[model samples]
Target: MNLSTEVRRLRDMDWGELDIKESGGWPFLLQLICCVLVLGLTLAGTYWYLAAPKLEELGQARTEEARLIRDYQSKAAQAAHLEVMREEMAILEERMNTLRDMLPTGAEVPSLIDNISEAAISNQLSIEFIRLRSPVSQEFYVEQPFDIRVRGGYHRIAEFLANVASLPRIVTQHDLTLEPMEDAGGEQLQLSMLARTYSYRQSGEEEEAP
Candidate 1:
């Protein structure tokens, strides 16, 4: 049919006379328009049902991929500097050991006393007394004090102090008093001092009741 005839037929079509069960008996124009409408609705419904979920899944997958990339970069950076971290740990351990070695044990106290006496004798000083006092307890270590009395010339006493200060173990001298011996005609000088050394306590030693 011509375009104008088809348009006129569509415009003048009667809907009430058409039989619902006899679609094939309908006019050609009416049937063609119904088929086009059904096809368009079917295509739109199919796209919404099948393609929407896949688009959401693609978006989630992209987000997960970005998170994994960030994790890999962080781990790679740590691995790159692993050797430097190990070297720093070794240096810290060495320094800790050196400090531990400087602390003496209980058994070594007598030897330390002997060393002090020897230092005094080496400097030509008279060691009158070297007595260990009661130990003072501290948080991490025990302070072992000593009462030292010596008689010598000024230069000899100075040398003895320097030698004691240079010992390997940690020792501190304080409360020093010097007086000339009147009976020795100002030739001999008396020196009195307090010396303290430290020893490490075992981990649970301080917590125990005496």
Candidate 2:
């Protein structure tokens, strides 16, 4: 009875009970709150330090990629336009060359004149007045002729005319005045004629053979 009562009295004592309550009190609760706060702060710091920069870099990369894509598309469009222009230029060049080949070259004038003179001699006609002049009208087939005047017998004149008619190129006589010569011989006659030679020429371009 003595031991049991003493133990009971000690348990019911206010100091002992207060000491037991203080042993496990608000300090522990404050330490637990501090630890929880530290853990939360560490997690927040980790997210800011590690994840934030990566997110920023990803956003920057997306922006740069978009810019590059736009540049590539613009360049592609320009390339297509250049290709079309090149094709058009090639076609134009081909057409221009074809037209050039179809046009005649004017380099045969000397030979043509020699042939005409030979034909005149073969026809027994001596050329007296052979005059060449620049074009007058500058229009096609309406220009003045290269002038020529001759004095010969009537048969020689007729033969010369026939020879001119047989030429390959178009040769025509204009402004003809035929009369008898006053020289002592009655067989001789005086002939005046104008002949025309032509070639083609465009504005600002050199003359060409036709």
Candidate 3:
């Protein structure tokens, strides 16, 4: 039909006479609009029933894949550095063993005391006394203290300290006192001090002299 005739029929159509039974007589414009509405509703319902759920599942799968990739990369980096970590641990253990050797053993303590005595004599200091004090128990070791009294020139006392520091075993001096002897014309000095050494506390190790 001509466009003008269809336009006039749509405008003059009787709304009350429109019915499903007479749909063939309906205006072309109205039929076209009804067909477009039905098609749009069908497409919308199809997407809701089928495509929507699939799209949602696809999004969740992408997120899980990303998480798994990140986890794998982190574990791979740790595996790559595994050898370096082992070497570092070995170095740490070797250094620990060397430090343990620096601590004196029970049998060696007598020799260590004798060495200190020799150091005093070699520095021209007269030893008044060098006696062991009570040992202190610690978590990892024992503290062996000695009360040392001597008479010597000032420089000799200093030299004795230098010798103690250079000993193969570790010894430290604390609480030093120097007083001038009454009749030595200020040339002779009396020295009193606390000397400390350590013995490692290991199972089945002999206890050093108390």
Clash-forming residue pairs, model 3 = none
lDDT winner between 1 and 3, please give it: 3
Instruction: Say which prediction, candidate 1 or candidate 3, comes out ahead on TM-score.
Output: 3
1-210 per-residue lDDT for model 2 (tens digits) = 365755665455565234534544434444455689999999999989998999999999999999999999999898979989899999999986675443323454455566668877887777786666665444432233566666688988888877876666556778888888778367788778877654545556643233
Candidate 2 matches the true fold with a TM-score of 0.43
TM-score of each predicted structure versus truth:
0.57, 0.43, 0.59
- Cα distance off (Å), candidate 2, residue 164: 1.1
Pick the winner on lDDT between candidates 2 and 3.
3
On TM-score, the candidate that comes out on top is: 3
Tens digits of lDDT, candidate 3, 22-106? 8887889889988999999999999999999999999999999999999999989989999998999899999978878888986
lDDT of 3 at 143: 90
User: Residue 131 of candidate 3: its Cα lDDT?
Assistant: 97
Q: Please list the C-alpha lDDT of all candidates, in the order they appear.
A: 0.89, 0.68, 0.90
lDDT of 1 by residue, 105-192 (tens): 9899999999999999999999889999988888888889999999999999999999999889999999999999998999989999
